[model samples]
Target chain A: MKVTLIAGSNREQASSTQLTRYMARLLEEQGFEAEVFSLYEHQLPLYGPGEAYGHEEVLKLSQAVKSAQAVVLTTPEYHSSISGVLKNALDFLNSEYFEGKPVLSASSAGGTVGVSSLGTLQGIVRNLHGLNCPEWISIGSDQRKFTDEGEPADQATELRIRKAVDTFVHLIHRMYG
Target chain B: MKVTLIAGSNREQASSTQLTRYMARLLEEQGFEAEVFSLYEHQLPLYGPGEAYGHEEVLKLSQAVKSAQAVVLTTPEYHSSISGVLKNALDFLNSEYFEGKPVLSASSAGGTVGVSSLGTLQGIVRNLHGLNCPEWISIGSDQRKFTDEGEPADQATELRIRKAVDTFVHLIHRMYG
Candidate 1:
């Protein structure tokens, strides 16, 4: 019923966020309640002795994560992996937040190899005891932008993104129902 | 003959720094030139279209990375992976910087599971084409600190740190030689 979306990019308004927002909108159109949590806004201290266990930010983040029915995480590939900001947030709530949640991962990259970041994240998530959607929503930079009229100027990419969103929505519905 | 150690933790001074500083000290004692760079202070911007290809900070960071004959990267584990700050910095540099250089990775975590960050980092460095030493250094939190004055508060941890340092230094010498 309630789905939480995490925008994993550190940039104020990244393509990953825009794409995820678009997907969230589609999910809403299909009758699911959704909320977006921008990871960049969470000011988490570096995990350490005094900070790792009971840091205020950690506790607050964990509480938010505990209440979610399903989570959608969006990230941009950095050095062939997920951003530290996202990983740090996930690290804080490990077995507690991720135990039985169905997580859908989506990624945006600058090249045809947008899937690299997705693959790396999948590997990391699999090892963390997460149940991930078998098909990930991956967008490369070939046709990264849209016009002011909200139309994708590049037809090929428009089709790809449409398919990605449809598949993701299907996966979420299957997982939740 | 100059080696630059990148301390990846966000803390002003961290165990990774302590361990990296120890390596620098050992290298200096053995008569090799070295310097340590605290990556947290670099404040690198997240990679974007214009930012990733070339930026002032990216140029400066890459220059530092390129100038070094060998590099020692130290990080704290977060979500079974390396920190984004360090990965961001590495992503700024092209593969030429790491093509044939020797790299040593060390990590300090709060528990036995700290090995995740180390393993993740090793995978990244290898993917970047850095010649990594097979033996990596991993220190759990229970063994890294002391009460007040310099003392071996935990003999077992002291021994592990010493062994880790020794292996790290030996590999550096071999790589540099």
Candidate 2:
């Protein structure tokens, strides 16, 4: 199955991006084709009505999401919710693109937990008609979760991520296998 | 007192912008200095961490909001909430710029009502430390609310907007008069 992992932060070297990469690796290890879609590479035009929606970047990102069998979304908390970059990217697409696809909601935060961001992502995914996994992965105190090489630093974080990814993979398989 | 009316849509001839301009006219009628800030004119870069914050447009917007005694925010409902263009523009600044400032939340929608968008905008303003007015203006079936000259079409919609603006102006006077 092809699963798309969206690193929802636009920041270079963001902890959220590191966590997304880790999830991608885990999916690959499980023998699934994982594509990491970095927000940095898809700098979308601000979505506004009557504005030209023919931007190549927006179309590329949309096509990727449309083609994926399932999706994994990772974001960093900003103002107690998902980052505006992620939300803005989502705004460019309609509910039809995400209809009935399983999505894994994951987040990393500077605080002890990223529950709020998880909830926000869940709400957004539901709004877009994507079925979000009940078991979400949130790496709190995120700065410590990743090492200098952009990999998960501790075994505990790795285990949590693996479990979450496994759950998502299983759900997708059950739904679309 | 100075009031900033933000036309939160990027469309060339959006009803949201028309309603924002209408509100600005009402404020002017009340002898308040009102400035209409159109998101189309701002054309802000997508906000992200570690991105250069020195963009002249961002700086100008920040200065305008910081200097205004009160702000009236208007948006078109996109996916049951504010437009991404408006939200991305907001991401360029921090809560400090809006601290203690009065804000009037307004919206125009294609449906029969825009209550959801009003609630969402209210929450966002509170998150940004802006004191939101309780009397919000939501123009539903928005296409019918405006004329060819980009003005409010009916006496009823005009009255509703005037009442909201009057309430906002009174609150600002009580706070900063």
Candidate 3:
């Protein structure tokens, strides 16, 4: 199965994106193909509510979500909520793009716990009518920094991510396997 | 005192903008100069973190927020949260612009109640370190429509808005008087 992973940060060197890349490696090692969508690389215009400027990036983004059997989103908790870049990307997409798909959410939190933004992210999933896996990954502020290959250096953090990956993949099996 | 009002919607005919304009009238009638920041009229690029491409619109948006004695934000709840356009505009700003300023938030709701988004918006104000007035406004889907001159047709809705305006203006007086 193929999964579309969104690295939902706008910073040039975002730990959230790095975490997404790490998760991509974990998913790939499990024999699933993973595509990482980075906002820094694939920029989008500010969305007009009803107007479609027909931007190329938006088309690619929509196509990625449309074709994926499942989707993953990684974000950094900014000011107790999800980053605006991620929120904007979600704005450009419609319910049909994510409908019935198994979507997983993760966070590289700035604070002690990233649960603040997760609730809002789940709300976004419900808004898109996507089936969001209950188990989500949250790398606290101190645990977010990763190596060059996007591997977490801390063992416990790595274990949490691995278990999250397993839970998500198992859920995907029930839906699409 | 000057109050900066943000019409936090991008729709061509957004009632949130209308509500903002209406509040402007109310603020003006009570002897406060009001300016409304609108996404539909003055657009901004998607924000890139730590990058100062220095768009003229961003400068103006920053200046408006920086100079206001008080600020009011009117957002339409999209997906049970604030609109992406509003969030993007806010992303371009920092706490220095809004610190200690009086910020009152309101919503043009898609669903029955907009409290769902207000809590998050208050979180945003807190992030900016602004003194958000405890009273907020929410126009339900039914009462969101307004006249071209920015007047609400519903009497009870108008009264509620007027009361919110009074509460906000009262708070502003306590802060700046």
> Per-model C-alpha lDDT, please?
0.69, 0.79, 0.82
Return the DockQ of model 1. Answer: 0.02
Q: Mind giving the per-residue lDDT tens digits that candidate 2 earns over A54-165?
A: 8888888888898898899899988899988888888887778876677888888888887788767755775675755646888878444677776788888888778878
lDDT of 3 at A163: 87
Candidate 1 per-residue lDDT, tens place, A74-138, comes to: 89878877778888777766655654355677887787656667656655554554544434677
Give lDDT tens digits, candidate 2, residues B1-177: 788888889997888898898788888888888988899988888888765478888888888888798998999988888999998878886778776677888888889778678767765775675665646788888444687776788878888888878767765764565
In candidate 2, which residue pairs get closer than 3 Å at backbone N, Cα or C atoms, i.e. clash?
none
lDDT of 1 by residue, B48-144 (tens): 6674556666677777778888788898877777888888777776558875466777887778647778767755664565655444677776656
Model 3 DockQ reads: 0.01
TM-score of each predicted structure versus truth: 0.47, 0.50, 0.51
User: How well does model 3 score by local distance difference test?
Assistant: 0.82
Which candidate number has the best TM-score?
A: 3
Error in Å for residue A162 of model 3: 41
What TM-score does the predicted chain A of each candidate obtain versus native chain A? Answer: 0.83, 0.94, 0.95
